[model samples]
Target: MQLAQLLIFLILFPLIAAFFLFLAKRDLDRAWIVKLSALTIGIVSVYLLISTYDKGGLMVSGIPAEPTGMIMFILEMLIALAILYLGIVHKKWLVVALIIIQSAVMLYFELVYAHAIHVQSNLFIDEFSNILALIIGIIGSLICVYSLGYMKFFHEHHPEMPDRRPWFFAVMFVFIAAMFGLVFSNNLLWVYFFWEVTTLCSFLLIGYTKTEEATNNAFLALWMNLLGGIAFAVAIVYLAMFGNGIMGLDELLASGKIIALIPAALIGFAGLTKAAQLPFSSWLVGAMVAPTPVSALLHSSTMVKAGVYIIVRLAPIFQSTFTGYLIAMVGALTFLIASGIAISQSNAKRVLAYSTIANLGLIVACAGIGTYEAIWAAILLIVFHAISKSLLFLSVGTVEHRIKSREIDDMNGLIVRMPKIAAMMVIGMAGMFLAPFGMLISKWAAIRAFMDAPYGFVFVIILVFGSAMTLFFWAKWMGKIIAVTSDGKNIEGEVDHSEWAALVSLAGLSLITTLVFPLLSTKLLEPFLMENYGHVAQLSQDNIIIMMMMLMLLVILPLSILIPTRKHRHVSPYMSGRTTTHDMRFSGSLGVQKKTVLSSYYLTEYFGEMKLKTAGIWLCSALIGIMFVATALQGVIL
Candidate 1:
């Protein structure tokens, strides 16, 4: 009962808080309500995870007895209407067209055909749901706490701007609530409802700042996600009509039809858009214009995770189909492209954003690989990436606030000005680098998963190349941050208490999560895999020991580098045959000094937004078109 109530609280609390928050928007004193509400949700989340430990499977609610096909048809009509309203308000005709077509399809499913309903299960709490709930509850809570600090600075930065904290925090919290609903739901239609709610919440949050740029980016996000939503609605409607009108995920999974591969791939396409896989990657990058905490919460910990979560959950059905190869190709391409682009970026935030897309691409690729080890790798990546990426974003925000810039060149010698925050940044960066850490552990697993597959060697090649690119981009940024003057003085900076709190908390969490990984694997992850996939394999004890030893060596070796740096006299960087002065300026012949500026090579000729947008849009459209044709062909082929 506590678990049931915990689930209820997780869903309803944020909704109730959103109403009250909107009501209290005019008063500054009500700001504390945001923090209080998030804390309550967090507490409930922890309680739910704990209560479910000794419990195996708990059903919270029963589905309505009405025929699910009729029910889905009705719900879809309402969704279409809601979307039409959005289109009219936003003046987006493309959304209007999309909704109209989806409505037409639903009409046919409802009136032209009749299908029998089958009832199997209602609401459920399995180990997978529990783990996702923990992620949403724990990491989502931390993001909220971090937001309190971040939003405060944001308001100070834009003092003349209208106060929108209520709407912002309300939407952010509701997003968390919706995610809880999504993962916990056994009813496919119920999950779909929650899914649409998340789409709405993300649309609102992405446009939180309401600048022209913010609104435009938000619209792009809206349209792209709507494309996915349409695909989801179509899949749900088909399942309701033909496959026993059940609309419960467990029933669908057990139905045993290759035709289900159609929806699986379509769902994966949705994940791609939401995960910001290349081609659709711009929406997440554009999302960076919002305040820092939103970026941290949405991109790092929550919204993006939802995309891959759906894909990973559906992996069993699609693994043996041609759709699997298609998915692997999409993921591998996204990984390679994003990593290559990240190499050319000078903006620290852009680097992080592209890296996120790249990592998510790798996760999606692992899901396509679909071995037990592959699924394990994907889940591990989700956890560790959440920790380190959120820390890095928050730290960067604090640094930008102090230094008045987001460029890496401006951050040179940051260790001199704000040593503690800089150290946190370095730690976060190192944690993300794919070697001797959680991220690397997952990458290695992914490589093995791909290599074991028949005719999957190409994916392995792409994965390896992407890994090298990732290393280069991250190392370049780290080196730039610590680059110093010939005289050896550190760069100077300062930050407030709120900034310090967020940075320290996230940094500490990243390290702690890594330490407890073995426990997480055995108790939380393995059970879920065994329940779903069957036949769990134990990781070699020797491999685990080697990783631990490597980590210990990192601790000892870094100390040596630090010790020598403090004692040795600093000297100028090597310059070719020219005696130079003024740090990065070298004397040319005849008394002229040439300034040597350090900036990343942003291969605009290849990866620039202007150069690639047209081609990407065309390819995305073509890929989506092929998906629809293939989905319809399922009926004919099977």
Candidate 2:
């Protein structure tokens, strides 16, 4: 089949499958439908990659935009209506107002500024979008398959909650479909339409339980993302009115800083909100209240990635401008502060959430630098972050199912209790910050990129300190996993086949991607960079050999723990109060439990969530305010 035909199928088939899933109702039927659809989507995506790997931006054609625009406009209005209805019913005036504002802006733009504009290309694909397509189709489909077992267990565990598995499965597929449409659409209008669809899907998924907390967090995510939607709508109007009739992302960016700065800043602000940086980060953190699969989908491949995708694509215009610096400063500060905040978190999901926000900040910082080297690092960050984070989130979810807790303290001796999953979880953790893994490697590239860019020293310092905080949190979690507990019993048997399949697959992909990154850079990233930026970034041959050596160390270090060694006397840790002998437990005064417990030092006083997040929010909000002020002054002076 032709590329266009396959692209259409890739976008539409998931929606079709979703419809069937909603109607199917039965567990076995939903499972089969998800598996088949995921398989087809993955295969089609791989085909698209194979066929188009060597090509430049291929402008997608053959769709009738006139009819399509009308359909999309109607659908968007319907979505707005739904939100308006819900907001009025729930008394969330903010949601109602946001919808009304964006609608007014878009309605006016479509009726006035967009009437006669012609886009040379409504959709285009290049190596970057190709890679994104693969991530969404492959990783996303795996998550869907994994959800099959998870939702079953979820319903069994919470019998009081009505079974909404059908709607859950349906929404997941729809989210995938929206992400595909988002990355594929070059026309800003189409991109915004798909973007809003994702926002609605996420809101639905987050509020699946219909509880008060779930509803609030879901609306939190909704309003935050809708704020971005409003900014995005205003940006479209600005570009159409004063941007030489720029209506496509390509046109807007290609027009350079002279024409793109103000609108680009607005759009970049939108990106920041969607990516959950700084002040907007709480929405994603709160989103952890939903099912773990929802967390995985939003953080890793689909919702948040869309934010960085657009920002990274605008790297060219962000270079060496006040707007760019504002973007970088926000990102850099977010990276540092978020990492520190992660250190105070004991909940496994919260740690994952903060880690995600920090890494995304790093990617945004790289994009703001806008060097060829910086873009290289940003792209690598996106790829590694997606694979590793999805693996970790899914592993944590599976662990929670088996162990019945998500607290870091609850996983004591996980290696002894659920060895297979513990090992897999450890692999996922190592991929995040350890040597020879893609995350560390990408960070290395980011460091080098920052070394030569503007204000390089400041970036380097932020990265250094932020990276240490990441090391602190991940090591703490991995320690909990690998530590042996005498009370633990093996329960790996409890995991379902579908869950294991997804975890093991992502874990394997994590390792394989790291091993072949050099080849990946040579074939995919290098050529794309050479074509687009006229320069290529590469690690030295010596560095490559050293990385291989570290990879060997990664293997040897894990196996070395199994080697026979002299048996030493185990000693009980001393506590001031009554202590249990050799049990790693102690009873103390001041509400201490009867059992001795050694918990990780959270330093909440120093790195508490409320304090750190409050300070960060105020600081980043100030930065954003200054960003717009600077943009206005520049516009006036120019």
Model 2 alpha-carbon miss at residue 555, Å: 3.0
Give the per-residue lDDT of model 2 (tens digit) for 1-638.
88777778888999999999999977788889999999999999999999997887788877657878778999999999999999999999999999999899989988997777777777888888898998999999999999988888988998989998888999999999999999988888888899999999989998998989999999999999999999999988888888878887778867867788888888888899999998899899989999999999998889999999989988888888777888888999999999999999999999999999999999999998888898999999999999999998998998898888999999887877877777777888898999899889888899999999877999999999999999999998888878765656689888999999999899889888888889888888888789778999988899889988888778655454444267634566556546655556566577475665547878899899999999999999999999899987877676
By summed lDDT, the worst window of 10 consecutive residues in model 1 runs over 485-494
| Cα TM-score per model | 0.89, 0.95
Candidate maximizing lDDT: 2
The list of candidate 2 runs beyond 4 A from truth reads 557-596
lDDT of 1 by residue, 2-38 (tens): 6556676777787787777766755354456766776
lDDT of 1 at 360: 93
